[model samples]
Structure formats: structure tokens, C-alpha cells
Target: MDAYKLMTIAAIGFFVFALDKNQKKFPAPIILIAAGMFLAVFPYFSSMELTKEFIFHWILPALLFTSAYQFPQDQLKRKAAIIVTLGTVCIAITAVMLGFALYAAGQLLVGVSLAGAMLISSLLIPTDPVTVVSILTQGNDKHHLAETIEGESLLNDGTSVVIFSLFSGYYFGSQSLHIGTFILDFFYTALGGAIVGLLISWFVAKGIHKITFHVYQVWLTILLAYGSFYIGEALGVSGVIATVVSGLLLAKELTNKEEEEEKELRRDLKNFWGIMEPFLLSIVFVFIGIESIDFIQMDGLLFVIIGFLLSVIVRGIVLLATIKSVKPWRKSYTNGDITLVTWGGIKGTMSLALLLSITGQSGGSDDGLLSWAFMMIMLSLIVQSLTFYPLKEKLGD
Candidate 1:
């Protein structure tokens, strides 16, 4: 099928799913994903193809920006301690643990080179904000808890992307990284994206302040989000960070403006993103399911299972080490929250994007590994997305 036509069908399918008021009973993402898989199995859909550019340029920025903008900045500030610790420190711990585990496991089980396995491990570690945050925040009325989860998801994505890029560079790309250079390397990438996002957000807000029309102003933000991401990426900075920072900054600035015109624009933008959020999320998972149809193979099943186990073990260790500081980490949240959060770290689009970005040496070693990576990611998303809420309810005692 032609790409345009297939996308039209996807849009129709998503609309049907999105219109369901009982969306809480069934995740729109998982449903659309299942639809895509069903379509893929049909012989008539043999021509479908998933484009990497479509994901990076279109789907990712929209999803990230919407997630970031919808995040409650004030709530995030209120939970600053938990957010900062988990976002920065805990995320780094999880990444390192997972990378080393993959290195050791690959050598023992797959005979893969240590560096290559580490690269793949880095790619797999970052939890997709789209999947994880959506599940965690669905119906929970605890604003502080919700903010902590959302804020952690927002900031950790950038950290994970930066680390993933660094390892990818060291192992597969030309840029060499030594242990001593790790601090400087991380700072440059992350700080570069943050700075770019902040500046652009300020400029865009100022520009929109002059525009009294609400529709155009909202559209301007959409442009700015994509623009900041692409520009930051062009500078070899973290585009994900740039996109997210730009969103948070815009959300903060717009939330505070007292003027009637500004308030109206903010409302319009909020409503617009609210509609787009589920729509885009559904489309993303659909793309994943359709792509999986082409990539999933039986021979790689064992490796996929191993990768999933590695993901869980590393996350478990990180949570155990980091859960000490959360005020109500134990008391307010049950043993279930701790376990669910640890196991609920679902890898999705960001991981796939990292893998897709691999080219030449950065990618050569992972040729046979891509199928396994893709399968593990699909499994992560399905297992966690489906189980997170039920587990939360079952374990909330």
C-alpha cells in the first residue's frame, strides 16, 4: 500500500479508538498497536513500510512536546527532590547497570563484543515517556506522585539519549570516549540541548506575545518545538532535551501570563495538544506493530528474552539503591509501586530511534542484533503497558 493511503487508514483507525470514552479501560496505544499487527498479518498489507525519518522528524517531537507541555510545572517543583534524584542520579545508575549487564551477558551467552553489547544496552535502557508516564498517571489523583513520575520521565529521556549517543559514538562511531571525559561529554550534550531549548522558547514566547490571534500562536509553538529539536540535533546536541526543555519553558511562560489574549492562546494550545496527544500516541504504537511484522523472527527469540531479563534486573538494582530517599517511597507508595516502577520501565520509540540512528561502524556490529532489540522493545511495551495498571491495583494494598 502507498504510504499516504496507509497513513489515512491509520488515522481513521486511531480516530475510532480515540473517540472511545472508556479509554481508561483500554489504552489507545495498545489497541492501535494490536490493530496494526492485525493489519500486518493480512496479505494485502505486504507493501507497508516504516520510515525512520517519519518517526524522528514527525512523531517523536510531537509526542515529547505534548507530554512535556502537559506536565504540571508547579507540581514538578513541589516534588523537586524526588524528581531531581530519580531523573538525574537514578537514571544514570540504571543506564550504567544495564550497560554492564549486557556486556557481561553478551559475552557469556551470545559471544558478542563487550563494546557492542554495551551500545545496544544503552539503547535499550531509556524508558519511553509516552508509554511509562501515560500508564503511571492515568487515573492517579496524587498530584505530587504524578509530577514526580512525569518530571522524571521528561528529564531522564535526555540523559538516556545523551548517554546512548556517547556510547554509540565510542563503540560504533568515530569519536573516542575515555573514562575521564565522561563528565565533560555528558555536560556538553545535555547542556547544549537545554540552552538551545531555553533560548528558543523565550524567543518564541516573545514572538507569540505580539501575535494576538490564538490559532496562529498555538501553531507557532508547534513549529518552535520541531525547530528547536532539529536545530539542536544539527549542532550535535541532544534534540530530545531541547524539545522537552522548550516545551517546559513554554508551558511555564504561558501558564503565568495574565493578559486575556495570552490566556486565550494558552487555552487554545492546551486544547489542541490534548487532542493531538492520544492521536499521535496511537499512531506511534501502530507504527511499531506494523514494523514488527517485518522484523520479528523466531531465531532471535532467545536473545530477546535475555535482553528483557537484563532490562528488568538492571532496573531492579537501580530502584533498590535509589528508593531510599523518596519521602513516602515506602510508606505512601506500597511495595507494589516500587516493584511496578522498576518493572514498568518500558522501552519504546526513543530506543528504536537510537538504534535506527546507527550507521556504518556505529551500526555494523548490531546488524544481527536489531531484530532482537526490536522484539525486546515490543515485548517491553506490551508486557508493561498491559500489566502496569492492573499490577498497581492488585498491589496497592
Candidate 2:
């Protein structure tokens, strides 16, 4: 099957799924992912192999830019202290915990090597919950929890990417890892991407305000998003950060003006983003399923169990630590708030992207890793994402 044909089928399914309300029993991402895995398992279609070029060049840009464009600046700033602190420190702490947990778990039961365990741990660390959250939480009462979770996930995605790069470099022949280098890598990658994003967002917002033609203005935002990621990466920074920062900047820069001109602009922006979001999301899940076909054959059942347990333990430890930090704010955190944050860290497309990006001998030995990563991601999104509401209600009760 041709790539275009596969995409066409996915697009058609996505459209049909979107139209039916009763069939909306499951989120589109979940459906697309399930469809992808089915396609991979059966011969409904040929495997949709996701190449490095596809992930690095196209999908990453789409994912990041979309993230940048839709990010909520006010909410992010409102919880800025919590977001930054948890996003950065919490991710690092989780990564370390994941590494040790995997190592310890393997030692106790399965007995995998340190590098293999760490590799699996590193791949699952970046939480991608934007798509999951949008589908799960469709109301205002859960807004605060959603905001913090989304904000932290966005930031942690970057942090995890940076950590993965450091460990990968060490694993390969890039350079020996050191504290100074890690700090430098994180600083430049995240900060540089954000600065570039802000700069581009400022100009793009101004350009949008000036343009009478909505189409042109929308294209400008799209161009800026794709362009900023490459530019940030070229400058030795984190493309993930650049994309997010750009989104953050756009959120801050664009006001919800009801004037005719502003309203038109808002409508155009909304339509443009709206069209892109689901489509990108659909493609992401399809890609995951397509890629999973190649991976499912490579590993055994134990890998999946180890991967799933490692992910849960690491996530549990991270949330437990976060709760401890907010111990002082226990009165304000409310039992509900803490529980929501703990449960809302659902992983999705971002994990798939990173897993798909890995290649050659380093990842070759760990062929089962991607399959495990996908399984863990599905488990997190399904179990944690849905249960949070009940958990919230219980806490409130």
C-alpha cells in the first residue's frame, strides 16, 4: 500500500469517527492507535514504516508547532512556578528513579543489563498527554488539574528529550556525560528554543493582526512553527522547547478581542488550528500502529511486563515526590488536586515519536523497547486518564 493510500484511509476513518457521537465511546487517539496496531497485526495494509526523516523532519515539526500554537500562556504563567519547578526537577528525578527501578526490578526478577533497562526507562520518561487530556477532560471543574498536567507534560517532554540525548550520546560515541555538560545541554536547548519561539511568535502575532487575509496569516503561523524548530535545532538547542515556546508566545500575544477584525482573525486561527490538531493526532496514532507491526515480532512478553512495571513505578515515585514537595501546600493542594496531578500524567504521541526516532545497533538490540513503550503509553492513557475523574470525585467526597 502506498503511503498516501494509507493516509487517505486513516483520514477517512478519522472523519467517520468524528461524525458519529455514539461511536465516540472511545477517544480518537485510542481508536487510531488500536486501528494502527490492528493494521500492523493483520494484512489489511502494508506496514507504514516511519523513517527517521519522517519523524525528525515532518512529524516533530507538526507536533511541536501545534503544541506551540495551542498552548495556554495565562494558565502556564498562573502556575508558572509549579510548572517550571516540576517540569524540570521532577522529570530529572523521575528519570533517575526510572533507571534505578528498572535496574532493581530486573535484578530482582527478570535480570536485564543496566544499559538495556536504562534505555527502556529513558524512552518512557517523556509524558505526552495533550491529546489524551483533551479527550478525557471535557469540562471546567477539572480545568486546574488539566492545566497543570498539560503544562508540566509539555515542559517534561523537552526535559526528557534532553535527558535521552545525554544518555544516548553516552551510550554511543558522542561524548562522556558530565554534570556541567548536562546542565549546559538542558539550558541551551530549552532556553534557546524558547527565545527563538518568542521572537517568531511576537512577529507572527503582529503579522496576524495586520493581515486582512486570514489564509495568509494562518500560513504565517504554520511556517513560523515549522521553521522555528529547525532553526532551534540547528543552533544546538531543543526543538521541542522552541516549538512549545512559540506556542506559549502565540497564546500570550494573541488577545481574545471581539472586534470584527479581531474576531475574524480569531475565527481563522481557530479553524486553522482545529483542522490541524485532529489530523496530526490521527496521523500520529496511525504511525504508532504502523511502526508497532515491525516491533511486535522482535521481543517477548517479559519485555512488555518489565516496561509496563517500570513505567508505573517511575511515575508513582515521581508523583509521590511531587506530593512531598507540595506537602507544605497540603491545605491548598486538597486531596483532589494531588490525586488528579498524580493520575493525569498520561503518556501518548510524544513517547511514540521518540521511540520511532531511535535506530541502528543501539536501538537494534532493544527492538522490543518501542513495542513496550507503546504498550506502556496505552496503559497510562487508558488507565490513568480515565480514572482521574472518579478519583477526583472520590477525593471531593
Candidate 3:
């Protein structure tokens, strides 16, 4: 697409977002997605494809960085155990359980392969940090819950990607899982990404400290955010984790700056990103909406519905079990907390991106997988986003 057309689409998305904000009755993402779907049928947008590379490389990194940058470091530390366990361990468990369940159902109904089902399961395991954090932090006073959710969302992407890659290889008959090898690969990817991110951010921070120009500092910070991701990917590590780690490290450094000029630079950078967050999200959600039109008429809607229902059940059961096992340290959580967390596991851009990746590799022959993934995501966003706030209020009271 041409520059003018790209700008036009972005402008339309922003306009929808503005309208949604003004009404304050529904979430902006839902509105943007609906508008994208409405506009996608037109000739002008029919050719505008939402590619996996475009989303995974160009859009996701920035969104992940922005969300992680703003996350409260102290709160994250306080709830580290909960966040890590939910993000990594619970996600793994859910993926395995959901994978087998879907595989059995597919065999009995539509005959999807075990590997294909597992691949789909892995892709949908990670909750979208962008959507969850956006909803959880909006006019909600439950800081601990919000922080736990945000932190988990940020970290879970890496876990999901690692799992997805393993299953993808298995699907292609390129790789097989050995427990020790899998553990080693997971740590190497995740930890290596974190190390790369920290080192890059440290160097960038040092450079910023010496630079006097506020404009240059702001621009450099943006570069560093993307730079960290690219560097991690170049090293064959988890770029998503790298971006998150870099953003968090940089955010910590900027927040701790006592120098007046550095503080001014930090303020300018934050102001710039504040506008960027919504702009990027509008484009992403709209793209999801547009891409979803193709899958709407997919075969085996019943299979997708069954998978969606199973996902919720599995998530709830896992949360209940995990919460019971790992006692909270800072505060006690009630049944309502478990309910909110279970519902708040809303899937968004990341899930779609992973699905697109699989479809691209498999020549799009995996019957009903794409449709199932899309419907599950839509169900999560519509049901969870609408009810989370009210549920939180009721549970709190």
C-alpha cells in the first residue's frame, strides 16, 4: 500500500477510537475491530493483507515495549512468584491439556492431526498483554491484581513463543522434544534474550546520560527499543522477551535519574510514547478485525466453539489449582480474584500472529485451526473485556 493509503487507514482507526472514547460505553478495541471488519470488504482494503512478519516484527515489539515500560517495577518484584508461575508454568500446563483435548475432539469430529492441534493450542496459550493491561488498568483501583496480570502477560509471550516453536517443528517433522533439551532451549532463549536486552539498554542508557539534546535522547530511546528486539532475534533468541526486558531496564534507569536535564528528557520520551501506545493498538486491533473476515465462514464452527469452551474451563481449573498451591504473600485473594483472573485471560494480537505464522508454514491446510483460534480470541475479548470491570467491582464489594 502507498503512504497516503496507510495514513488513511490509520486515520480511520484513530477516528473510531476517538468515538469509542467519547461514548465510554464499550472498549475502544472492540469498536476499532468492528470498523476494520466493516471496511475490509471494500475493494481498497481487500488486498491489504495482515502478514505474520508485519505483526511479529514491526508492531508487536513496540506494543510490548510500551506496556512493559510503564509497568510498575516494585509491584512486579513483590508479585514475581505469582506472575512467573502463572505466565510460564500455568501456560505450559494449559497448552498441553488444551492440545490433547482439541486433538481428541478433532479426531472424533473433523480429524485434525495431534501435532496440528498441539500447535494451535500452543499459539493460543499466551494471553495478550496489550489487551489485558489496557482493560485492567482502566479506572481500576486493584493495583496488585492489575500488576500481577500485566506482569504475567508481559512474560508469557516468551513462554508461548518457545512452546509454539517446539510444536511447529514437531508439526513439520523437523524436531522432536526431549525434556532436557526442551528445558535447556527454553532457558537459553529466554535468559539469553533478557541478558541481551539488559546489556543493550544499559549501553543506551549510558549514551543518553551523556547526550544533552532532549530530542536526540527521545529518538535514541525509540531506536534502542527496536534495536534490542532486532539484536535478540539476530542472536536466535526470544525478541519479545528482549524487548520487554530492555523496556523495563530502561524505564527503571530513567525513573531513577536525579539530574534535571535527564529528568526532562525522560518526561519528553514518556509523553511521546503515551500517544504512541493507542495509535499502535488501534492499527493492530483493526488489522485483526480485517483478517478475521476470511475465517468467519470457516468450516467446523462447532469445533471452534468446543475449543473455546474448553479453554475457559481449563483456565479456570488451572487458576484454582495454582492459587491453592502457591499461597499469596502480600495479600489474600478471594474467590472473586480467581474468577477475575480466569476471565481476564483475554487473547489478542499475539495469538493471531502465532496462528498466521502456522498457517503460512502449513500452506493453510489445517482445517478449522485458524477459525478456532480467531473465534476463541474474539470470544475472550468480547466477553472478558466487557465483564472484567463489573466483575472486579462486584468481587471487591
Candidate 4:
């Protein structure tokens, strides 16, 4: 048995659940990350590693599924236009600009293609909802701002997955990739995943109608969540998107029902996930803390710093350009809200997990890039997270 898993559970039991039950004063992510970092000093943890296969295949699907299912559909529908634009279009723009910037810099990137560099940086683009939302709830979160944040993260993370998958295929796969091929692939991957997810969700919904037992319902949904992802992957599409789409639609279906039994089932589903999400999240963040140290060092510090700056700066600029120029966003959102949204784009577990999974595929050769991504993520968490509350206070709802 791996002691890392045991250690993570202990840390969650003691630090997360016991001490920070409210998580108002000290958030779980920060606490778990600190625990992981503290534990990393031991000799045994120095060589600890989590494979990309485990992360992508096992952990990724569950985390993606839970977040998607729990996300409120009303908020997504209301903010559909802005959220979709920010999540997809802005993300694509930021990725391209950042990729070009890195390519132009010509430092820290060694023989890596534009797609490869974009793949590394795109992971940083999707802000962590759990980290931001937890902090927001501690303050005056209004205008469904917290939901907006969560929705943005959920949508953008899905977009990030598409971007990562597309780039990964083009950069690594044996094919003569060109602009036309890339554009076509970008659509195919995303649309393909959506179709797969919806079909599975429709079938699952039909099954859910006939099921009476709560336990059986939960079991079936579990299958749907993990199953959608596996099926999408097997079908040569995007599993990440599939899991998200299925979970989102199915969750909405459960929540939208007016019947008492449906409501009770929703409660049961919520209770199950209420326990499961945190357990999984704690392990991921703690593991990030332990594994991140190996990726950070003295030489790549400049590149990491630059990468972090570019990520933050580019995101802010893109948001400003996108929101201010657009008529609907300009009227709906104030400059202050934009500021909050921009600054609140705090990177957490999602970024690190995606990066780890990406780095895991390359083995030992891209340690420099891996270290750069890790360091940049640390900067986002430390600099952005610690300042998030005070920033929120200053920019009142």
C-alpha cells in the first residue's frame, strides 16, 4: 500500500475536516497543500511520483464528473453567452497569444512546438472553482457571482481539456498537422465529446426514470459519469468533455424535477458527492504539494516567473478587451466586477493536475518545462489565493 494515499487521508481527516470545518479562516486547499509540502521533506516522499495514466484515467474522470454535476444549470443558462465566450473564445485567444509570446521569447522552450507550449500554458488558463468559490462564500458573494465563477471554471476547464487534447494529438501524434487540420480537429474533438456525453446522459435519464432505490440511482449515475468518459475516449473523442457534459445535463435533470421523490434523490446524490468531492480534492492537492517540489529548481526560475506573469496579464487583458467591447457584458458587468473576475482567476488543483498529467506523459526529458509549470502554479496559488479575500473586500459586490 502506498503511504502517500494514507498520509493524504490523515491530513484531510485532521486538518481539513476537523480543524477547518467552516474553512472560513483557513481553506482546505491551502491547508492540504501546506501539509503535503511539509511532508515532502522526508526521504520517502522525495522519490514519490503519480503516473499520468492514473491521473488521467482514474482521478480525472471522477473530479470532472462531480464538479460538473454539482454545478447549477440555472446560472449556466443565464450567463450562457458571457460564460461561453469567456470560457471558450477568450481561452482560445489567450492560448494562442501566450503560445506566440512564448515562441517569440525563445527561452525555456527547447525544441518544443507552438502547440506543445500552448498545451503547457493552456492548463494554467482554467481557474480553480473550488479554491475561488470557497473563498468567495466567506465574503459578500452576490449577483450569483460565485456561481458565475464556478460556471466559468467548469466551462473553461472543459475548454482546456479540448485544447490540451487537440494540442497533445497534433504535437505528439504521427501526422502532418497544418492550420486547416488543426481547426477541423478543434471542432471535431469538442463537438464529438458533446455528442457522446448527451447521448449517454439521455440514456441514463431514461434509466433513472425507472429506478426507485436511491442506492441504485447513485450506482447508475456513477456508471454514467465514469462510463461517459471511458466511452468517449474509446470512441476517439474527448473524455474530459464527455464526463463534464453528461454530469452537467444529468445533474440539471435531477435538480429541475418538482416531485418529492426526485428532490429526495437529489439530496441523496448531493450528500454522496458532498463527501466524495472533498476526499478526492484533498488527495489531489496534497499530492500536488508533495510532487511539485521535484519540478522546481534554481535555473528555470526566470522562465517560471515570466510564464506566471504572462498567464495573469494575458487573461486580464483578454477579459478587458472581450467584456468592455461587447455591448451585453459592458452593460451587465462593472469594471470592478471585471477586476474581481480577473484577479479571482486563481489557479489551484485543476491546473496542477492537468500539468502533472501532461508532464507524466513525457517521462524525464521535459523536467525543465514541468518545473516551470509547477513553479508558475505555485505562484498563482500563493500570490493570488492569499490576497483573494482582501481583494474581494476592497471590490464589494
Candidate closest to the true structure, highest TM-score? 3
Tell me the tens digit of each residue's lDDT in model 1 across 274-352: 8877766666677677777766888757767887888888887777667755566655655556676676677877787
Colliding residue pairs in candidate 2: 68-247, 189-238
| Global local distance difference test of model 4 | 0.76
Mark the regions of model 3 whose C-alpha exceeds 4 Å error after superposition: 22-25, 329-331
Task: Please write out the lDDT profile of model 4 over residues 18-75, one tens digit for every residue.
Answer: 6676664466777778877887898776556766666677677888888889877777
lDDT tens digits by residue: candidate 3, 1-397 = 5576578668976787676653224677777788778878887876678888888888888888888888887887777888888888888888889889889888887788898788778876888644445555665465666787788889899899999888888888999856666678889999999999999999998998788888888888789889988899999999989999999998899888788876787679778888888887787887777787887755777787787777878888888888887565324666777787787788888888887786656676664667777787787777767766667667773
How does each model score on TM-score? 0.90, 0.88, 0.94, 0.90
Instruction: Give the deviation of candidate 3 from the true structure as CA RMSD.
Output: 2.0
RMSD of each: 2.7, 3.0, 2.0, 2.6
lDDT ranking, high to low? 3, 4, 1, 2
- The C-alpha local distance difference test score for the whole of candidate 1 amounts to 0.74
Q: Best-fitting candidate, measured by lDDT?
A: 3
TM-score of structure candidate 2:
0.88
